[model samples]
Target: MYRLKPGIKQNPQRRWELPDRIFFGHGACHILAGTYLEIAPLKGFHAERIIPGDGFAGNHIFVTDGEIAFDFHGYSLRNKLLLHHTSGWARVSDPGWYCRIEDVDFNLLDTRALNARKMLGPDQYFGDPRIRARSFLERIDHIDSVKKLARNVD
Candidate 1:
């Protein structure tokens, strides 16, 4: 059986703001999302909606096959083992001055789910959240869109 592990506890009143850092000439989180989405499938993994905060809800996520756990590279964040936008070396905490998402594990944050309405409604955006998430997946799949929406807050 799959489990709905506790994710982040965010204030729904606040909208997600873009990460202040410009990573690889684009928004840090966007680049993180895009790049990770680009690589996940090659390893037989798919993208899942997640909540971002100090750390991800779980070290594992439920997939159709089963549950998969985080693949931290011997060292994760000291900050509550916070999930990197992408996991592995040169990850969210270690994107360096500029880098790519290759050779990295996917984010532990991706293990957590974001309540669609609660997360998006405050921004006055009303639509199926899956649409946007899947769209981003498709974009990354085609290598056309490197932009991922950072729509939820922690």
Candidate 2:
């Protein structure tokens, strides 16, 4: 549930042949974070899309408001998010462990997120991440949390 590999362990591409739900916190992370970035403003919160530098694991996308990060696992301290993606290495193994956020680069709203089919290529493994993200938010009852975060920010 933490590392980048399918479910925190190495898996063949054939494993990814499953549904997007199977890869929720794994491969479909970009879509989840991108969905948050797209919806934050509408909910009255300001967030920036973040793409960790090469120092970290594989490609990962998340949103930050300078304090908290919103990703596939939901909200977390912006600083701690990197630790969750050490690519199976120890938390301290990553060169950016201490300053991962500082080394991160900003990304614009991902166009691929707009169409689930465009995310991972022609497979369309994920039907529509936006819908999935919304479902996750609702299922977790995070509407109030989102409102609280929004209210606390400028």
Candidate 3:
């Protein structure tokens, strides 16, 4: 059985935000196609075509069957890493999409689901055993710290 997961929590302190201009819908290739057309000023990437289908929250966007192409500026390892890490199911949270890379097959993902699944790595998609253990320990530590602080206050 397919299991749908809850969306990720965005960091409230982050400075960056997705522009409100990007409208999401399930069969809205026209909107996506228009956004691609407008992004030409950026000069590095362009959408070749848009195939309409379902996405996260039942939104739609155009997506290619194979790898999507984009152009980059001069050699920069940091930029390369950013692009690489953000690709596939790795960057879903940027658009409020909740799907994860290692958890779902990309070929079968619709635009909405793909968007939702972006940004999540295998560790975030699936809980890490070590982290879970550490979290319990951290909770204990937090209680101890709070007790000490309370005693000092008293």
Candidate 4:
């Protein structure tokens, strides 16, 4: 079964909804296929990052934003994602062929965020570490969400 992965579709009608102020945080989960669920920087998505042997748990994604006050690579991130949108760490079920935001407990997009530049930024394979360490981890940086998110991956 081929489910649609979220991205900026050429057709506006096809755009997925996202909650307001959702910084994809960092990192992405890889599904059975070669595709990945990385932060849609909107520009720097590299196929090279998602390797067959690479697990989504430890892979680092360069996330940047001024408001994020949590760990960029751990449990804190999962909370933030759940609290804001795409609840329960999205993943594919019912055969587990791909990862998708299924039966979300919360709404996915802010009315404004979907149409704004928020999702149009460039996706980086690796961003500035100094900024990432400081910016992505302001409030809850110690907790790791890899395990929390892994459960969702079937």
- The runs of at least 3 residues in candidate 2 whose Cα sits more than 4 Å from the true structure, single-residue gaps closed, are 1-22, 41-57, 87-123, 143-154
lDDT of 1 by residue, 1-154 (tens): 1221233123221212311121111212223333334445334444333333333222222221112312111112222222343343224242332322122234422222222212222123223223343444444332211112112111
Model 1 RMSD, rounded to 1 decimal: 14.5
Q: Quick one: how many clashes does candidate 4 have?
A: 17
Candidate 4 per-residue lDDT over residues 57-116, each given as its tens digit: 222122222222222233333335333322222232222222232221211222233125
Off by over 4 Å in 3: 1-25, 48-154
lDDT of 3 by residue, 1-154 (tens): 1112223124311211221121112122223333333433223432332221236332222322123322111112333323443443334433643422221233221335434634222223233322332332333343354355447556
The candidate that achieves the highest TM-score relative to the unseen native structure: 2
For candidate 2, the 10 contiguous residues with the lowest summed lDDT are 98-107
* lDDT-based ranking: 2, 3, 1, 4
For model 1, give the 10-residue run with minimal summed lDDT.
145-154
lDDT of each prediction vs. the true structure? 0.27, 0.51, 0.29, 0.27
Runs off by more than 4 Å, candidate 1: 1-9, 13-127, 142-154
Q: Report the error of model 3 at residue 7, Å.
A: 23
Q: Give the local distance difference test score of model 3.
A: 0.29
TM-score computed on alpha carbons, candidate 4: 0.19
